[model samples]
Target: MSENASATELTSQYTAQVTADLERNTKEQERVGVEIAALQEQLASLQRDHTVLVNIQQAIDAVPVPDSTAPPSGNVPVPAPRKKAAPSGRAERTRPSKKTRPSRKTAAQPAQTAGQTAGKSTGKSAGKSAGKPSAGKAEAVQTAQATLVDLVRRHLTEQSEPRSAAEIATALGQAHPERAIKTTVIRTTLEGLVAKTQAQRSKQGSSVFYTAADPSRSAATARSEEQPEPADA
Candidate 1:
Protein backbone atom coordinates (compact mmCIF):
# COMPACT_ATOMS: atom_id res chain seq x y z
CA MET A 1 0.00 0.00 0.00
CA SER A 2 2.88 2.43 0.76
CA GLU A 3 4.52 1.53 -2.56
CA ASN A 4 1.30 2.37 -4.54
CA ALA A 5 0.87 5.62 -2.64
CA SER A 6 4.51 6.59 -3.31
CA ALA A 7 4.08 5.95 -7.04
CA THR A 8 0.88 7.99 -7.16
CA GLU A 9 2.60 10.90 -5.41
CA LEU A 10 5.49 10.74 -7.83
CA THR A 11 3.04 10.85 -10.81
CA SER A 12 1.26 13.92 -9.45
CA GLN A 13 4.51 15.80 -8.89
CA TYR A 14 5.72 14.93 -12.45
CA THR A 15 2.43 16.11 -13.97
CA ALA A 16 2.58 19.34 -12.01
CA GLN A 17 6.18 19.90 -13.12
CA VAL A 18 5.24 19.31 -16.77
CA THR A 19 2.29 21.69 -16.50
CA ALA A 20 4.45 24.45 -14.98
CA ASP A 21 7.10 24.05 -17.67
CA LEU A 22 4.45 24.18 -20.42
CA GLU A 23 2.97 27.37 -19.01
CA ARG A 24 6.42 29.01 -18.77
CA ASN A 25 7.22 27.99 -22.34
CA THR A 26 3.94 29.45 -23.61
CA LYS A 27 4.55 32.74 -21.76
CA GLU A 28 8.06 32.95 -23.08
CA GLN A 29 6.81 32.43 -26.64
CA GLU A 30 4.24 35.19 -26.22
CA ARG A 31 6.88 37.59 -24.88
CA VAL A 32 9.28 36.79 -27.73
CA GLY A 33 6.54 37.29 -30.33
CA VAL A 34 5.66 40.68 -28.88
CA GLU A 35 9.31 41.70 -28.85
CA ILE A 36 9.78 40.59 -32.45
CA ALA A 37 6.71 42.55 -33.53
CA ALA A 38 7.97 45.68 -31.79
CA LEU A 39 11.40 45.27 -33.32
CA GLN A 40 9.89 44.93 -36.81
CA GLU A 41 7.85 48.10 -36.38
CA GLN A 42 10.95 49.99 -35.24
CA LEU A 43 12.88 48.62 -38.20
CA ALA A 44 10.21 49.72 -40.67
CA SER A 45 10.15 53.20 -39.18
CA LEU A 46 13.94 53.48 -39.40
CA GLN A 47 13.92 52.33 -43.01
CA ARG A 48 11.35 54.94 -43.98
CA ASP A 49 13.39 57.64 -42.21
CA HIS A 50 16.55 56.44 -43.92
CA THR A 51 14.90 56.73 -47.33
CA VAL A 52 13.70 60.26 -46.61
CA LEU A 53 17.09 61.37 -45.27
CA VAL A 54 18.82 59.94 -48.32
CA ASN A 55 16.48 61.87 -50.60
CA ILE A 56 17.04 65.11 -48.67
CA GLN A 57 20.78 64.50 -48.64
CA GLN A 58 20.80 63.89 -52.35
CA ALA A 59 18.77 67.04 -53.01
CA ILE A 60 21.16 69.04 -50.82
CA ASP A 61 24.18 67.51 -52.54
CA ALA A 62 22.70 68.43 -55.92
CA VAL A 63 22.60 72.16 -55.10
CA PRO A 64 25.88 73.81 -56.17
CA VAL A 65 27.54 75.81 -53.37
CA PRO A 66 28.25 79.40 -54.46
CA ASP A 67 31.96 80.20 -54.32
CA SER A 68 32.16 83.34 -52.17
CA THR A 69 35.97 83.64 -52.22
CA ALA A 70 36.48 83.83 -55.99
CA PRO A 71 36.74 87.27 -57.61
CA PRO A 72 34.19 88.40 -60.24
CA SER A 73 35.26 87.78 -63.83
CA GLY A 74 36.11 91.30 -65.17
CA ASN A 75 36.08 93.76 -62.29
CA VAL A 76 39.87 94.32 -61.76
CA PRO A 77 40.67 98.05 -61.33
CA VAL A 78 43.32 99.90 -63.40
CA PRO A 79 45.79 102.06 -61.41
CA ALA A 80 45.85 105.84 -62.22
CA PRO A 81 49.19 107.26 -63.47
CA ARG A 82 50.99 109.43 -60.82
CA LYS A 83 52.54 112.83 -61.86
CA LYS A 84 55.84 114.27 -60.58
CA ALA A 85 55.78 117.47 -58.35
CA ALA A 86 56.87 120.73 -60.15
CA PRO A 87 59.94 122.72 -59.00
CA SER A 88 59.39 126.20 -57.37
CA GLY A 89 58.41 129.01 -59.91
CA ARG A 90 57.98 126.58 -62.77
CA ALA A 91 54.82 126.85 -64.95
CA GLU A 92 52.91 124.18 -62.97
CA ARG A 93 49.54 124.60 -64.73
CA THR A 94 49.25 121.11 -66.02
CA ARG A 95 45.74 120.51 -67.52
CA PRO A 96 44.57 116.96 -67.01
CA SER A 97 43.92 115.45 -70.47
CA LYS A 98 40.43 114.31 -71.64
CA LYS A 99 41.95 110.80 -71.99
CA THR A 100 42.98 110.85 -68.30
CA ARG A 101 39.47 110.30 -66.88
CA PRO A 102 36.26 109.90 -68.85
CA SER A 103 33.20 111.53 -67.12
CA ARG A 104 33.83 109.25 -64.14
CA LYS A 105 30.56 109.55 -62.11
CA THR A 106 28.37 109.78 -65.24
CA ALA A 107 30.00 106.63 -66.68
CA ALA A 108 29.40 104.64 -63.46
CA GLN A 109 25.83 105.91 -62.88
CA PRO A 110 24.13 103.74 -65.56
CA ALA A 111 26.26 100.71 -64.67
CA GLN A 112 25.36 101.00 -60.98
CA THR A 113 21.69 101.39 -61.89
CA ALA A 114 21.86 98.37 -64.16
CA GLY A 115 23.61 96.40 -61.45
CA GLN A 116 20.91 97.25 -58.90
CA THR A 117 18.23 96.22 -61.36
CA ALA A 118 19.97 92.96 -62.05
CA GLY A 119 20.34 92.33 -58.31
CA LYS A 120 16.64 92.92 -57.75
CA SER A 121 15.67 90.55 -60.59
CA THR A 122 17.99 87.82 -59.34
CA GLY A 123 16.71 88.22 -55.76
CA LYS A 124 13.12 87.89 -56.94
CA SER A 125 13.95 84.83 -59.03
CA ALA A 126 15.86 83.24 -56.16
CA GLY A 127 12.99 83.88 -53.78
CA LYS A 128 10.54 82.27 -56.19
CA SER A 129 12.74 79.21 -56.75
CA ALA A 130 13.51 78.80 -53.03
CA GLY A 131 9.77 78.73 -52.30
CA LYS A 132 9.29 75.83 -54.73
CA PRO A 133 11.53 73.35 -52.91
CA SER A 134 9.79 74.02 -49.61
CA ALA A 135 6.50 73.11 -51.24
CA GLY A 136 8.08 69.99 -52.70
CA LYS A 137 9.46 69.00 -49.31
CA ALA A 138 6.03 69.45 -47.78
CA GLU A 139 4.52 67.18 -50.41
CA ALA A 140 7.30 64.67 -49.81
CA VAL A 141 6.61 64.65 -46.09
CA GLN A 142 2.94 64.07 -46.74
CA THR A 143 3.75 61.18 -49.05
CA ALA A 144 6.31 59.76 -46.63
CA GLN A 145 3.77 59.78 -43.82
CA ALA A 146 1.90 57.11 -45.82
CA THR A 147 3.74 54.09 -44.49
CA LEU A 148 3.89 50.40 -45.57
CA VAL A 149 0.57 49.70 -43.90
CA ASP A 150 -1.03 52.50 -45.85
CA LEU A 151 0.50 51.24 -49.04
CA VAL A 152 -0.86 47.80 -48.35
CA ARG A 153 -4.21 49.29 -47.62
CA ARG A 154 -4.10 51.29 -50.81
CA HIS A 155 -3.15 48.23 -52.83
CA LEU A 156 -6.03 46.31 -51.36
CA THR A 157 -8.36 49.19 -52.08
CA GLU A 158 -7.37 49.14 -55.72
CA GLN A 159 -8.14 45.47 -55.99
CA SER A 160 -11.68 44.13 -56.55
CA GLU A 161 -10.77 40.75 -55.08
CA PRO A 162 -8.99 39.45 -52.00
CA ARG A 163 -5.21 38.99 -52.32
CA SER A 164 -2.63 36.85 -50.59
CA ALA A 165 0.40 38.43 -48.96
CA ALA A 166 2.77 37.05 -51.61
CA GLU A 167 0.63 38.50 -54.42
CA ILE A 168 0.50 41.88 -52.68
CA ALA A 169 4.25 41.88 -52.09
CA THR A 170 4.91 40.88 -55.69
CA ALA A 171 2.67 43.58 -57.05
CA LEU A 172 4.32 46.20 -54.86
CA GLY A 173 7.76 44.91 -55.77
CA GLN A 174 6.92 45.20 -59.43
CA ALA A 175 5.55 48.68 -58.97
CA HIS A 176 8.56 49.82 -56.93
CA PRO A 177 11.46 47.76 -58.08
CA GLU A 178 13.82 49.78 -55.93
CA ARG A 179 12.03 48.79 -52.75
CA ALA A 180 12.81 45.30 -51.42
CA ILE A 181 9.32 44.44 -50.20
CA LYS A 182 9.28 41.02 -48.62
CA THR A 183 6.28 38.73 -48.22
CA THR A 184 6.91 38.27 -44.52
CA VAL A 185 6.94 42.01 -43.96
CA ILE A 186 3.83 42.39 -46.09
CA ARG A 187 2.11 39.63 -44.09
CA THR A 188 3.06 41.24 -40.82
CA THR A 189 1.90 44.63 -42.03
CA LEU A 190 -1.36 43.07 -43.16
CA GLU A 191 -1.82 41.56 -39.72
CA GLY A 192 -1.31 44.99 -38.20
CA LEU A 193 -3.89 46.45 -40.57
CA VAL A 194 -6.25 43.66 -39.56
CA ALA A 195 -5.73 44.47 -35.88
CA LYS A 196 -6.58 48.09 -36.60
CA THR A 197 -9.66 46.96 -38.56
CA GLN A 198 -8.34 48.77 -41.59
CA ALA A 199 -8.16 45.48 -43.45
CA GLN A 200 -10.08 42.18 -43.46
CA ARG A 201 -8.93 38.60 -43.77
CA SER A 202 -10.71 35.53 -45.21
CA LYS A 203 -9.71 31.89 -45.35
CA GLN A 204 -10.34 29.68 -48.37
CA GLY A 205 -9.37 26.06 -47.70
CA SER A 206 -5.69 26.30 -46.64
CA SER A 207 -5.09 29.72 -48.16
CA VAL A 208 -5.72 33.01 -46.29
CA PHE A 209 -6.45 36.22 -48.22
CA TYR A 210 -6.83 39.85 -47.33
CA THR A 211 -8.75 42.89 -48.50
CA ALA A 212 -9.23 46.45 -47.46
CA ALA A 213 -12.01 46.95 -44.97
CA ASP A 214 -14.96 48.97 -46.10
CA PRO A 215 -15.78 52.32 -44.58
CA SER A 216 -18.38 52.20 -41.81
CA ARG A 217 -20.82 54.11 -43.99
CA SER A 218 -20.55 51.58 -46.87
CA ALA A 219 -20.81 47.84 -47.35
CA ALA A 220 -17.79 45.87 -48.67
CA THR A 221 -17.84 46.21 -52.44
CA ALA A 222 -15.69 43.13 -53.03
CA ARG A 223 -17.92 40.89 -51.03
CA SER A 224 -21.01 42.45 -52.54
CA GLU A 225 -19.72 41.89 -56.03
CA GLU A 226 -18.45 38.38 -55.37
CA GLN A 227 -21.52 37.36 -53.50
CA PRO A 228 -25.01 38.44 -54.57
CA GLU A 229 -26.91 41.40 -53.20
CA PRO A 230 -30.30 40.69 -51.69
CA ALA A 231 -33.26 41.70 -53.88
CA ASP A 232 -34.48 45.20 -53.03
CA ALA A 233 -37.63 45.07 -50.86
Candidate 2:
Protein backbone atom coordinates (compact mmCIF):
# COMPACT_ATOMS: atom_id res chain seq x y z
CA MET A 1 0.00 0.00 0.00
CA SER A 2 2.89 2.45 0.79
CA GLU A 3 4.50 1.77 -2.65
CA ASN A 4 1.19 2.56 -4.45
CA ALA A 5 0.81 5.79 -2.45
CA SER A 6 4.39 6.94 -3.38
CA ALA A 7 3.72 6.32 -7.12
CA THR A 8 0.51 8.37 -6.99
CA GLU A 9 2.36 11.41 -5.34
CA LEU A 10 5.16 11.40 -8.00
CA THR A 11 2.58 11.39 -10.86
CA SER A 12 0.74 14.35 -9.28
CA GLN A 13 4.03 16.41 -8.97
CA TYR A 14 5.06 15.76 -12.62
CA THR A 15 1.59 16.85 -13.89
CA ALA A 16 1.81 20.11 -11.84
CA GLN A 17 5.33 20.91 -13.27
CA VAL A 18 4.06 20.31 -16.85
CA THR A 19 1.11 22.62 -16.27
CA ALA A 20 3.42 25.51 -15.01
CA ASP A 21 5.79 25.19 -18.01
CA LEU A 22 2.86 25.33 -20.48
CA GLU A 23 1.51 28.52 -18.86
CA ARG A 24 5.02 30.21 -19.02
CA ASN A 25 5.36 29.29 -22.77
CA THR A 26 1.91 30.78 -23.51
CA LYS A 27 2.87 34.10 -21.83
CA GLU A 28 6.13 34.30 -23.84
CA GLN A 29 4.23 33.68 -27.11
CA GLU A 30 1.71 36.42 -26.27
CA ARG A 31 4.56 38.96 -25.62
CA VAL A 32 6.30 38.06 -28.89
CA GLY A 33 3.00 38.53 -30.79
CA VAL A 34 2.50 42.00 -29.30
CA GLU A 35 6.08 43.10 -30.31
CA ILE A 36 5.57 41.76 -33.88
CA ALA A 37 2.29 43.70 -34.20
CA ALA A 38 4.04 46.96 -33.16
CA LEU A 39 6.84 46.39 -35.71
CA GLN A 40 4.27 45.72 -38.47
CA GLU A 41 2.45 48.98 -37.65
CA GLN A 42 5.75 50.93 -37.80
CA LEU A 43 6.63 49.37 -41.15
CA ALA A 44 3.22 50.30 -42.56
CA SER A 45 3.64 53.94 -41.41
CA LEU A 46 7.10 54.19 -43.03
CA GLN A 47 5.76 52.73 -46.31
CA ARG A 48 2.93 55.32 -46.33
CA ASP A 49 5.35 58.19 -45.75
CA HIS A 50 7.63 56.92 -48.52
CA THR A 51 4.67 56.71 -50.94
CA VAL A 52 3.71 60.34 -50.15
CA LEU A 53 7.29 61.51 -50.75
CA VAL A 54 7.39 59.70 -54.12
CA ASN A 55 4.09 61.34 -55.12
CA ILE A 56 5.45 64.81 -54.16
CA GLN A 57 8.61 64.20 -56.21
CA GLN A 58 6.47 63.14 -59.23
CA ALA A 59 4.40 66.35 -58.93
CA ILE A 60 7.55 68.49 -58.82
CA ASP A 61 8.90 66.71 -61.91
CA ALA A 62 5.60 67.36 -63.76
CA VAL A 63 5.55 71.15 -63.08
CA PRO A 64 5.56 73.20 -66.32
CA VAL A 65 8.09 76.05 -66.84
CA PRO A 66 6.73 79.48 -67.86
CA ASP A 67 8.25 81.21 -70.91
CA SER A 68 8.79 84.84 -69.85
CA THR A 69 9.84 85.84 -73.38
CA ALA A 70 6.40 84.86 -74.77
CA PRO A 71 3.95 87.71 -75.44
CA PRO A 72 0.21 87.54 -74.53
CA SER A 73 -0.27 85.55 -77.80
CA GLY A 74 2.12 82.84 -76.41
CA ASN A 75 4.53 83.08 -79.32
CA VAL A 76 8.22 83.25 -78.44
CA PRO A 77 11.61 83.04 -80.16
CA VAL A 78 13.01 79.83 -78.63
CA PRO A 79 16.25 78.44 -79.99
CA ALA A 80 15.99 75.49 -82.42
CA PRO A 81 16.07 72.17 -80.62
CA ARG A 82 19.13 69.97 -81.11
CA LYS A 83 18.65 67.04 -83.51
CA LYS A 84 18.60 63.59 -81.91
CA ALA A 85 21.82 61.58 -82.41
CA ALA A 86 21.55 59.21 -85.37
CA PRO A 87 20.98 55.59 -84.33
CA SER A 88 24.20 53.72 -85.09
CA GLY A 89 24.79 49.95 -85.09
CA ARG A 90 28.55 50.45 -84.41
CA ALA A 91 28.14 49.50 -80.71
CA GLU A 92 28.48 52.54 -78.31
CA ARG A 93 30.85 50.50 -76.18
CA THR A 94 33.35 50.20 -79.07
CA ARG A 95 33.51 53.84 -80.12
CA PRO A 96 36.92 55.59 -79.72
CA SER A 97 36.80 58.63 -77.36
CA LYS A 98 37.86 61.95 -78.93
CA LYS A 99 40.91 63.70 -77.44
CA THR A 100 40.12 67.17 -75.96
CA ARG A 101 42.56 69.81 -77.28
CA PRO A 102 42.64 73.56 -76.48
CA SER A 103 41.91 75.82 -79.49
CA ARG A 104 44.90 77.42 -81.29
CA LYS A 105 43.63 80.97 -80.55
CA THR A 106 43.53 80.34 -76.80
CA ALA A 107 46.90 78.56 -76.85
CA ALA A 108 48.58 81.47 -78.68
CA GLN A 109 47.48 84.03 -76.08
CA PRO A 110 50.18 85.20 -73.59
CA ALA A 111 49.89 83.72 -70.05
CA GLN A 112 52.31 86.07 -68.26
CA THR A 113 50.06 88.86 -66.74
CA ALA A 114 52.42 91.65 -67.79
CA GLY A 115 49.73 94.30 -68.18
CA GLN A 116 48.31 93.81 -64.68
CA THR A 117 51.77 93.81 -63.06
CA ALA A 118 52.84 96.92 -64.97
CA GLY A 119 49.72 98.82 -63.95
CA LYS A 120 50.21 97.97 -60.28
CA SER A 121 53.90 98.94 -60.33
CA THR A 122 53.15 102.20 -62.10
CA GLY A 123 50.48 103.08 -59.52
CA LYS A 124 52.88 102.32 -56.66
CA SER A 125 55.64 104.49 -58.19
CA ALA A 126 53.24 107.38 -58.70
CA GLY A 127 52.05 107.13 -55.10
CA LYS A 128 55.65 107.20 -53.87
CA SER A 129 56.48 110.26 -56.00
CA ALA A 130 53.55 112.22 -54.58
CA GLY A 131 55.46 113.25 -51.40
CA LYS A 132 54.16 110.13 -49.61
CA PRO A 133 56.48 108.86 -46.89
CA SER A 134 57.24 105.25 -46.02
CA ALA A 135 53.81 103.77 -45.22
CA GLY A 136 53.56 102.77 -41.52
CA LYS A 137 56.72 104.53 -40.26
CA ALA A 138 55.79 107.95 -41.64
CA GLU A 139 52.21 107.73 -40.36
CA ALA A 140 53.42 106.77 -36.86
CA VAL A 141 55.92 109.67 -36.71
CA GLN A 142 53.34 112.17 -37.91
CA THR A 143 50.79 110.97 -35.37
CA ALA A 144 53.27 111.18 -32.46
CA GLN A 145 54.48 114.61 -33.55
CA ALA A 146 50.90 115.88 -33.83
CA THR A 147 50.11 114.67 -30.32
CA LEU A 148 53.19 116.40 -28.85
CA VAL A 149 52.41 119.61 -30.72
CA ASP A 150 48.83 119.53 -29.48
CA LEU A 151 50.02 119.19 -25.88
CA VAL A 152 52.47 122.08 -26.29
CA ARG A 153 49.82 124.26 -27.93
CA ARG A 154 47.41 123.57 -25.06
CA HIS A 155 50.08 124.50 -22.50
CA LEU A 156 50.92 127.77 -24.26
CA THR A 157 47.26 128.68 -24.67
CA GLU A 158 46.62 128.08 -20.96
CA GLN A 159 49.55 130.23 -19.84
CA SER A 160 49.26 132.79 -22.66
CA GLU A 161 53.01 132.51 -23.13
CA PRO A 162 55.64 130.48 -24.94
CA ARG A 163 57.45 127.64 -23.09
CA SER A 164 61.16 126.83 -23.30
CA ALA A 165 62.18 123.18 -23.81
CA ALA A 166 63.33 122.97 -20.18
CA GLU A 167 60.03 124.45 -18.96
CA ILE A 168 58.04 122.10 -21.14
CA ALA A 169 60.08 119.11 -20.01
CA THR A 170 59.64 120.07 -16.35
CA ALA A 171 55.84 120.37 -16.73
CA LEU A 172 55.66 117.08 -18.59
CA GLY A 173 57.79 115.42 -15.93
CA GLN A 174 55.48 116.66 -13.19
CA ALA A 175 52.37 115.56 -15.08
CA HIS A 176 53.81 112.11 -15.78
CA PRO A 177 56.44 111.78 -13.12
CA GLU A 178 57.01 108.09 -13.83
CA ARG A 179 58.08 108.73 -17.47
CA ALA A 180 61.50 110.02 -18.48
CA ILE A 181 61.52 113.02 -20.85
CA LYS A 182 64.85 113.37 -22.65
CA THR A 183 66.13 116.90 -23.15
CA THR A 184 66.96 116.16 -26.79
CA VAL A 185 63.36 115.20 -27.65
CA ILE A 186 62.04 118.43 -26.14
CA ARG A 187 64.60 120.49 -28.05
CA THR A 188 63.93 118.73 -31.34
CA THR A 189 60.17 119.22 -30.96
CA LEU A 190 60.76 122.93 -30.21
CA GLU A 191 62.94 123.26 -33.31
CA GLY A 192 60.24 121.55 -35.41
CA LEU A 193 57.69 124.05 -34.10
CA VAL A 194 60.01 126.96 -34.99
CA ALA A 195 60.67 125.53 -38.45
CA LYS A 196 56.95 125.22 -39.02
CA THR A 197 56.63 128.95 -38.14
CA GLN A 198 54.31 128.14 -35.23
CA ALA A 199 56.88 129.53 -32.81
CA GLN A 200 59.56 132.29 -33.00
CA ARG A 201 62.99 132.02 -31.39
CA SER A 202 64.94 134.99 -29.92
CA LYS A 203 68.42 135.14 -28.35
CA GLN A 204 68.57 136.17 -24.70
CA GLY A 205 72.25 136.02 -23.57
CA SER A 206 73.38 132.39 -24.04
CA SER A 207 69.87 130.89 -23.76
CA VAL A 208 67.18 131.00 -26.44
CA PHE A 209 63.66 132.19 -25.62
CA TYR A 210 60.82 130.87 -27.81
CA THR A 211 57.59 132.80 -28.47
CA ALA A 212 54.33 132.01 -30.24
CA ALA A 213 53.85 133.98 -33.43
CA ASP A 214 50.61 135.87 -34.08
CA PRO A 215 49.50 134.71 -37.52
CA SER A 216 47.59 137.93 -38.37
CA ARG A 217 49.53 140.68 -36.54
CA SER A 218 52.24 143.19 -37.49
CA ALA A 219 55.71 142.91 -35.88
CA ALA A 220 55.28 145.96 -33.58
CA THR A 221 51.97 144.73 -32.08
CA ALA A 222 53.47 141.27 -31.58
CA ARG A 223 56.45 142.85 -29.77
CA SER A 224 54.17 144.92 -27.52
CA GLU A 225 52.02 141.90 -26.66
CA GLU A 226 55.17 140.01 -25.66
CA GLN A 227 55.95 142.57 -22.91
CA PRO A 228 55.11 141.78 -19.27
CA GLU A 229 52.24 143.57 -17.44
CA PRO A 230 53.15 146.87 -15.65
CA ALA A 231 53.54 146.83 -11.82
CA ASP A 232 50.43 147.73 -9.72
CA ALA A 233 50.34 151.41 -8.56
Best by lDDT: 1
Candidate 2 has a TM-score of 0.29
lDDT of 1 by residue, 1-233 (tens): 99999999999999999999999999778556644674676687778877987887678557654443554344443445666766666634564667885676766676666666666666677677656666777777776644566678899999999999999999999987777788987887787666556788999999999988878623454455579768999
Give lDDT for model 1: 0.74
lDDT of 2 by residue, 84-110 (tens): 564587557454455553444454343
- Poorest stretch of ten by lDDT in candidate 2: 68-77
Off by over 4 Å in 1: 1-39, 54-108, 121-146, 217-233
Question: Would you give me the overall lDDT of model 2?
Answer: 0.58
What is candidate 1's TM-score against the reference? 0.52
Q: Clash totals for all models, in order? A: 0, 0
Pairs clashing within candidate 1: none
Top candidate by TM-score: 1
